[model samples]
Target: MAMFVHVTSAANAPRIRRSGIRAVSHGQGDARGVYCFPVLPSYTLTHQWLRELARFGSRGGLVAVHVRLDDDEEVLLGRYADRARNAQATVPAAQAVRRIAELDDPRGWEVFVPRAIRPRELHRIRTAPQVAGWRYRPDAHGTRPCTCFGCRVRGGYGARRLRERLPHPLDGPPPPVRVLLARVAAAGEPGDPVVLREVLHWFGMRRRGPLDRLAHLAAHPDPGVRKDLVWAVAGWSTPGVGDLLDALADDPRDEVREAVEAVREPE
Candidate 1:
């Protein structure tokens, strides 16, 4: 016996039909348990992680619990891009369901388990397909993304219009405050901190180039390029923008000294 599904978040199906599928583990340091996928005689590769776990659902409904491990239960398995790699973590549960049913692209395998699943080995929850699998991984549709700065997603929603329409050579499409004032006046290295924080997210538009060549990027040693040069000169009223926000409020990076006191608390 071997069957699995998981998918999740139809408002967690009534607390997983009361105390059943709980093992919760999310982001940074992942691996607490209960991450399924394996029933594949391909029902879309057995619910390939329903649109990447319905992108952390805050209202976006999704489901699919289904269970029943039995065959020497004890899983861990691998490769959803090496679930934070550590090599073939344990096995058994019917040999990780016959090693992803003899994979011919088991769409990036994954199977965890490590504890909770009770409500008598579940076996039903239903209503899935909130736009089926593959969102930010697995065969990442036609490639070219990984824009690097740890795979881009800060301030996400359309993230700066997808980095100015597919940019990212070192992350950007930003460069013309007259060619960044000729690369900060022909320097030995003033550039790539993700393209100088994408050209300081447009120093509040219509060009803002010199202040002694942007006050030496307030000692820029990359706190995301001095929090994008204190958020592109936080609405400058220039008079050396308060001594470049007092030399970036002595930034040692608490997000560039809290964005230099959120740009001097809205003056």
Candidate 2:
């Protein structure tokens, strides 16, 4: 059997000790699982997720609840950089533990077990290294501002201004202002979001108008259109966009909510 650790707030320690970690996402609907890190040979790596969990846990000290799983148990594995549901691969529990141990530096990897960890599988609970792990993501410290708009903290101090000003090296030149406006004006109501989706890319946030023209997309039957609308509104400084966002925030689809939270102001 391979061992893993689930880092959580101290407030949860007691309940976990009594009942084991449940098979449930904290709140999200589809990410149902117990998120954990495989216990590796390196102590630093084994407990690397401590700090990151505690930051959001905000329930006093943090603890690592050790779990022992059968070698044949299946689990989802992925880079921590991706969203929880975006699994990179699924492998046996022992393989995940063995693979991480073999890697020189598997810094951003994480594991997710799909079922409840029974108390019998709970090996032990202990204080984890509070200083371990990365905040936000592994490359965040002293790195260039993340160019992927969805991944960065948009509401952080000066963030909106910074995103507006800087373009990543890999980005192609944005469309000419006149051309972007013309595209929006010329755009027709298509059943598919593909046409308007391309127009949003032309805007690139430099100019913020034509809100009335793009408003229909907010409630389009296609969720891709709704999500695209959220991304487009994120760049513009126009009014009515918030109302659009408010409507989309309540969308039933997980992808739509993910887009809304990605750009929505920090609450």
Candidate 3:
């Protein structure tokens, strides 16, 4: 059986194990298992861990590291560079685990195995396979702003300002944007992240309109949904936008309050 080690916070250990991987503790003395690292800002990337990982990989162990480029870009990039320098093919977490499972003896594969694409190339390629039933906007500009969770956490001013100045999709013709808004309104409590993201993007695509329906969702119980709603309204100069933001500025959740305050209009 394939053994897996997750080097993340204790809080995330349960979630990792629930995914069917036998998450072992760090000091379990099981050095033969594949080690998985999640590159989050909260996790400290220490030199000791790097050295241990290098030693493990050198001895034919698999290493799977999931990186969010929008957050801690330089740090994660440097770690990934080290992994590539060590001759480990950096594949996605899921793919890496599958490959490890298929191999009877991981050591059989050469350390410097050359694949069709390098890790850097794979990093540059952005695809939507991870998000099922979602499609990229055909008209999306390469320089267009992204307000997704990762981008927001990264806190890029250019992207945030561009998104703020853009218009709302609801202000456009009644096609996909209208259809998407309807779905968002009809969605049950605690909205879906994918749908919410697209809706927020739509809000950033057009400049004028009340978007009353979205304003109503500002009171969503989920703080994340409420935060997205705040961001959607931050760019609008339409009627009631200020009042809506004012109400959210005092939200019970600190995250919601911070998000609203970040873009709230001066009183």
In candidate 3, which residue ranges exceed 4 Å CA deviation? 1-176, 265-267
Local error of candidate 1 at residue 122 (angstroms): 17
Indicate whether candidate 1 or candidate 2 has the larger lDDT.
2
* Tens digits of lDDT, candidate 3, 169-264: 444322355776776766655677667766775675455555676776777766777787778777877788888888888889998899877775
Q: Candidate 3, residue 115: CA error in Å?
A: 49
- Estimate the TM-score for candidate 3: 0.33
- The window of 10 residues in a row where model 1 has the poorest summed lDDT is 202-211
Choose the strongest candidate by lDDT.
2
Per-residue C-alpha lDDT of model 1 across residues 38-57, encoded as one tens digit per residue: 77766887887787666645
Q: Evaluate candidate 3 by giving its C-alpha RMSD to the native, one decimal.
A: 18.7
Candidate 2 overall lDDT versus native: 0.75
Candidate 2 C-alpha lDDT tens digits along 78-148: 77655545646889999988887787778888888988889899999987768987776665789766656
- Candidate numbers sorted by lDDT from highest down: 2, 1, 3
Best by TM-score: 2
Q: Give the TM-score of each candidate.
A: 0.31, 0.57, 0.33
